[model samples]
Target: MDINLEMINLIKGEFDIHVLIELPQTMLHANIFDLNANLNEYDSLTSFWPVAGKWQLEYLEEYFSGCESVHFVIYKPGSKLDLIKTTYKVLKFINKHKFDYLQFDDFSARQAFLLPFLKLNKRLILSIHDPIPHGGEFEWKRSVIKKMFYGKAKAFITYSSFSKDLLRKTLGLDKQVVNLNLLPYTVFRKFLTHHTVEQERGYISFVGRLSQYKGIDLFIEALPTILKEFPDQKFMIAGRPAFGYAVDSSKLANMASSVSVMERHLSNQEIVDVISKSKLIVCPYLEATQSGVVMTAYALGCPVLVTNTGGLAESVLDNYTGMVAKAISSDAIAAKILDFLKLNLYQDMHAHITGDQLVSKLSSSNLETLSQIYI
Candidate 1:
């Protein structure tokens, strides 16, 4: 469905909004992180840099049709000389152009190291998705360099309240902070509108690259108890594990009849295929912040059962959309999972989850907020 949502409100001011994203071959069709990729900031006008890639025109016409305001200047530079060359190209381009406001959309390796030291005259803003690296993935040098990166931005935007608060305490700045909710990844909208999965809804899944803070092992541990009651209940674990972490093939092998694991990178259509068929998505995080996975589940009209850590609990409206585990233990997770199934909450949640309003509202709110601050 190429549903072109007409925004109810246009930002009050008139300025060219330029969003910068320099990463390794990331797609506007893949995520909501490239927020401006599909959303318009101005009520009736849209503008793009002369150098905008012709390849992106298809995505714009299909998903971003009739939208106004922000235009993304995405430049992905290669290693060594190419990196230096493209860095200068981007900087020079910025100096040469006249965007009323420019925002670095997210943290990228090259941007973090080079952006702070550059001498550009334009107003700059940064949106930090992860204020700190997850528990086991931290490094001292990255932290030091990241602090310098934090110092350059004139304003900050975060999707999670937890990250906004932590960034303040960690960086000691509070003014010009904007907190907005993450929008559902709409890359799946077309697939969902056309095809429907044939499987009866019983699968409960853990999606996303398996990482230490993600608590995949805890989710596995809680499974036996859930299986004891709903003996035929299905379980699916998707996505490749991060470095130094592994999912035991043998551990899940015992319950082979009921478990399905896809340990590799998943395409956008494949993700929609799984979440759309499943009744519940699980995010058993042991630590905090926000989740894009939870947002995807909402898009598919599938409810989630998340651990009561970070922004996971805050993201789910318990008893309606989904439920949060009382504690971060296997037993607590199982208990909530059981409650959701026993009460037959899936039917009501599935019916209520059709995501059109939620998606449009998130965009509308963020655009309005940005208009106020960027002025």
Candidate 2:
């Protein structure tokens, strides 16, 4: 999304920090010429190109002109033309205005390649998001550190402490590592509101990318046992398969007669609606780092049942915000779900922990920490 004036105002007013966000397209088309002067032509195939280019250029100009401590959050990597253009634009801007820092979220991408171009600017933040399981223990870490060292990153940011620990202890780069939690504001504003009270629903919900590691099969396996005790209970699984992962719809369908599966990407509002409407949100992940889904459940005041893997427990206090099951076992997940069902603590806990209060606390902490870094 383009950084609007409202977002600019919010950053300036709330945190007293001036941010100049380089538009994505300006970086994308950095060196590509208007090859045919057909940049304005609405060709069915390439119509999106020029429009995106113009939009990004406009946003970049406005942002660079307005703010002093300019920061560019690069979303794409290794588009040579884009990288060259971005490097040129940034160099010119830095020479003209003296930018304090150039930050990148995906450090492994073009950031590494573009570092030599910006070697004059000593301030660079190279971040990484390890969203999947890395099987090799020490060897994988050594390689990651080697990459970071080559990248010349001043600061390194990651989503979880597990990965951070790999960078810190194994690579001995603790001084450079920073932990930045993912925000769930999109889900919060979409599904959660103070006005909505608890509603009774017969089914339990799971929303996220449907994959083997996500343990949807395990949830399916536990259904029969859960059905034995509570005959009326139903299971709802939402979200599509991860990109390039094989998804067997018939296999999922065969698991249970009462299962309701929505195999498509749900909008933020739809996700909130489903979670808010359900009795509980179940995260039966085989592995995870930190979960944006768990945070969404918490912010929506939906009681959660998560596995004791990764950073799931970090956000969920046992028997407080939600319940944590034993690691990677269907029976354990089932037991926790049954326990939460038996206790019926959904309403009481929901009333106790205010969503706005939690959101404000997280938002404030993030802003405070980020402000210190920016300054």
Q: Can you write out model 1's per-residue Cα lDDT over 1-375, one digit (the tens) per residue?
A: 111111112332233333333433345443322222422222112244332343333433333333343343344323465556556666666666655555665555666646754564536666777888897888787677666656766788787888888778766544467786666655555455345555566789998877888998888998899999999899999986776777877778778898899987676567778887789999999986888788778867889888888766767878778888889999998998899889988988776667466556767777777676677
How would you encode candidate 2's per-residue C-alpha lDDT over 311-368 as one tens digit per residue?
6666676887788987678899888888877887777667644456655665566566
| C-alpha local distance difference test of each model | 0.67, 0.59
- TM-score, every prediction: 0.81, 0.70
- Give the Cα error of residue 102 in candidate 1, in Å: 2.2
Worst 10 residues of 2 by lDDT: 31-40
Evaluate model 2: give its TM-score.
Answer: 0.70
Best by TM-score: 1
Clashing pairs in 1: 40-68, 41-69, 42-69
**Each prediction's Cα RMSD?**
6.1, 7.4
Which residue ranges in model 1 land beyond 4 Å of their true spot? 1-15, 23-79, 112-122, 193-199, 355-364
